[model samples]
Target: MAVHRTVEPSTSELGTFTRQNANTIHGHALACLVAADRYAHIEHEIKPSLHAGDTVICDRYLASTLVLQRLDGVPLEFLLDLNADILMPDLAVILTASPGLIAHRIAERGIRHRFHLDPTMPGREVDLYAETALTLTAKNVKVLVLDSSNATPSELAAEIADTLPDPR
Candidate 1:
């Protein structure tokens, strides 16, 4: 099994686009860049690994777009349409925690992106992720929602691993 992320190898053109300040780019434009990166990621990394009989675990996928892009003022339908041709995950795991806990963790870790500047974003993200879970489920993607508020990292990994089908 291998773990992959949407924007990888930060030096790549698409990865650079993802690192740009949100204020410098239009929301719709960023969404397009992200979708393009996803396609590139699938073709360059995910599909090849899967063909070799490897399980690829993506850190973020369509669900992230459904939530973050929507936060940037893009409509759901536009996002859905933009991402309509992307590869869908077999299992979409959504790890969540209480808004307060999430906020506290972010504070401790310091802000990484423009979204973290808004204090209300934490609560909004929690709500959006819950909604995203249902949306993914409706698309026939197996959705697993885990609360990370109280569990340790190891515990959460074990729980997620338990839900995976045996590769045998």
Candidate 2:
């Protein structure tokens, strides 16, 4: 199994820029940077791993872009166009939780990004993710909406694994 990320390698210029400037960058520019990083990630990591017969699990992908960039005031159509050529996942698992639970978790972890600064962000993100799930489904992507409000991470992983088609 090979686990890839949208901003890959961690040391690449694109990844560094996206991470370091995420809070300060404008939405449109950030979206473009993220799209570029994704394409690079696919070429460098995801494709190679898949060709080697590894199961590539991406931590975040187009679904996340659709939600997060939209939260940054970028339009949905713009985001869709930005990410139009990316590799679609066979299974896009969207984990959701109640707003209260989400807020509590964010509070416990401390804020990592500008989005976490808003009091209403947790609710908005949950709602957006729900909407994103439907959008992905309409695009013919297999989506698994899991409620993580009460389940342990191990339990969630088990459920996700079970959802995968058997190899044999």
Candidate 3:
């Protein structure tokens, strides 16, 4: 299994774009553009993994853009249009937890991108993710909403693994 992130090195130009725009939507357009660019860059890896029969688990995929861009005031239609051709996951897992717990986890593990830095972002992210799950479900994508408030990482992985198709 290969794990891919939207920003590969985390210090690439796209990573810089995310960091510089962490607090507000002042740089929303540029960030969205960067996401589009990264999508193209990341596709090479995803395609090869699938061809080689690996289960590729993307840390953040198109669903993230739907939530984050909407938070920046971009309409859902626009975001959807931007990512219409990207490969969809077999099971889109929407992991959720209380905003307070999310904030605490960020504090403990360190913030990844600008979206997690805002003090008020957790609640909004939680709500938007939930909404996005519903929207994707409506569109017939397989979605699994799992609350991580009390589950350990191993337990969460086990639960997710159980959802995978049995090879036998």
For 1-168, candidate 1 gives per-residue lDDT tens digits of 554444331335776767564556658988887888778888887888778777778777899889988889899899999988878988888999999999999999999788888999999999999999999999999999999999999999999989976663
Model 3 scores a C-alpha lDDT of 0.73
The global Cα lDDT (0 to 1) of model 2 is: 0.85
Highest TM-score: give the candidate number: 2
Q: Rate the local accuracy (lDDT) of all candidates.
A: 0.83, 0.85, 0.73
For each candidate, C-alpha RMSD in Å? Answer: 2.1, 2.0, 3.5
Across residues 70-150, which tens digit of lDDT does each residue of candidate 3 receive?
877778887777777767777788899999999999999997766676799999999999999988888777888899999
The true-versus-predicted C-alpha distance at residue 23 of model 3, in Å, is 7.0
At residue 143, candidate 3 shows an lDDT of: 89
- Candidate structures ordered by TM-score, highest first: 2, 1, 3
Query: What is the per-residue lDDT of model 2 for residues 1-168, given as tens digits with 9 covering 90 to 100?
Result: 444444332346877888799989969999998889888988887888777876777777888888999999999999998888888888899999999999999999999999999999999999999999999999999999999999999999999999975442
Error of 2 at 53 (Å): 0.6
Worst 10 residues of 1 by lDDT: 2-11
lDDT of 2 at 59: 75
